[model samples]
Target: MKGDPSPKTETHKITGLILAGGQSRRMGQDKAGLIYRSRSLLDRATDLLRHLPVGDIVVLGREDTKYGVRDTEPHLGPARAIRNWLRRQDKPMNLLVIPVDMPELGREQLYELLAHEKGAYFHDLYLPFYVRAAKASAVHASTERMRDLISAFDLTELPVPVHWRTALMNINTPDDLRALEERQLG
Candidate 1:
């Protein structure tokens, strides 16, 4: 039996999670609704997920029942929003989490994360995480900070290539958005 062929591994269902439930205090508005490249950030995020092989896509923050699910408790943070969403899932699945503010993130970066069998994220970046739904309780038990939640799980820290550094930039303020726009134009 040493050379026996092994059974095929079952692929876990993947759910694309867009974390849009931020108060946007720094930008003084809802970051999800901000217009970038003539489309709302939320729309861009959804489109990115749609291009992937995910089974379902969920938006956490807005109240549009069609594709959005409001966080169990609003304005808490990304960690709490993710925890709430994971707890409500009917079954365990793989979650590809992204933030609405990361406009520069492309399919290539996401695909890179998907390449890892165990969950993986950029070395220093906390968002754009690929995690398992079965770890919901672990997330819930962690502190509200995203870094704390990341430490609760065994996730690989992928090295970011030089070309992908811009993709990790998060637009947290009007200045950041303006700088991104300038870079795009120039």
Candidate 2:
């Protein structure tokens, strides 16, 4: 009974973890609140994960929130929040992490990462990733940089898709978000 996963959880193969606790210094506002095709970045990330094989979804940080864990450390980058969530898990489970600012990440793209031996990530962009829960401590100790943490593994590195590279871009600043909205219109 102690080791058994709940029926609901048992049916899920992967757990979706939305990392939304960033300070958004560059964006000049909550990046999660930014609009992307009418939906907020936070809503889009959660919705994309829901279309996957994930058994459950949790968000890290953000107040007045729903379906997530608070960052506890606030803007200490992703390591603090991820580590906090990792230590709370009763058992090792596969985790799919997606940053709230990556508005264009889709189910197909995430699936590509999960298809790897361990997991996969864009050659440079690494927030949206697939990692086993067991590596939480290792990842925490590894580095605060998302790319470094993920690259330490023998995971597949994806090449930038020339056509959709903009879609995968991170909206880190107000200008970045504005540029993307302009691209969408033009």
Candidate 3:
């Protein structure tokens, strides 16, 4: 459960992780590189992380020369991808994980997740998680689903406000992207 309503301070030293290594099977193209509001999804995700108090940010599932940490295996799904990445870490720190396809996610939403002292995610959502790296070994689930991973950690679930629901929209297909664009424009 969430211990305090206070915001996490700069001294907390959180590492931001952008999960962008999906195969984009439904989108038919790399969703990470997809353009939205004139910026790539990866860039948008990175920019959102940069605005937070995180100490460092890493982009997983990509091979960029900067900030990118390639997964040992491609298309491992979000849970396994995260697990693999966490296993390579040298020290323990809080991790803020977000997906590249969530183009509508904002810093305000992310701040809400970070407000929890322990591991937490929005109710009914798996991405945009605040996980304690020290507890990585506690996730022993054999399933690769993110929901199972979250449950294994016993992370608190913060209620998402009605207005912020759209912020959780994940653009997995071209139609989804078009719908988001229309909603944004309309």
Listed per candidate, the RMSD to the true structure in angstroms reads: 5.1, 5.8, 2.8
Would you list the rank order by lDDT, best first? Answer: 3, 1, 2
lDDT at 21, model 1: 85
> How far off is model 3, as Cα RMSD?
2.8
- Local accuracy of candidate 3 as per-residue lDDT tens digits, 97-122: 99999999988888777777677899
Cα error, candidate 1, residue 127 (Å):
0.5
lDDT of each: 0.80, 0.74, 0.83
lDDT of 1 by residue, 95-164 (tens): 7899999998988888777776667789889989887544566665556888877777677888989998
TM-score of 1: 0.89
lDDT of 1: 0.80
Q: Which residue pairs show collisions in model 1? A: none
TM-score of 2: 0.85
Q: Candidate 3 at 92: error in angstroms? A: 1.9
lDDT of 3 at 45: 94
Worst 10 residues of 1 by lDDT: 1-10
Best by lDDT: 3
lDDT of 1 at 121: 84
How much is 129 displaced in model 1, in angstroms?
0.7
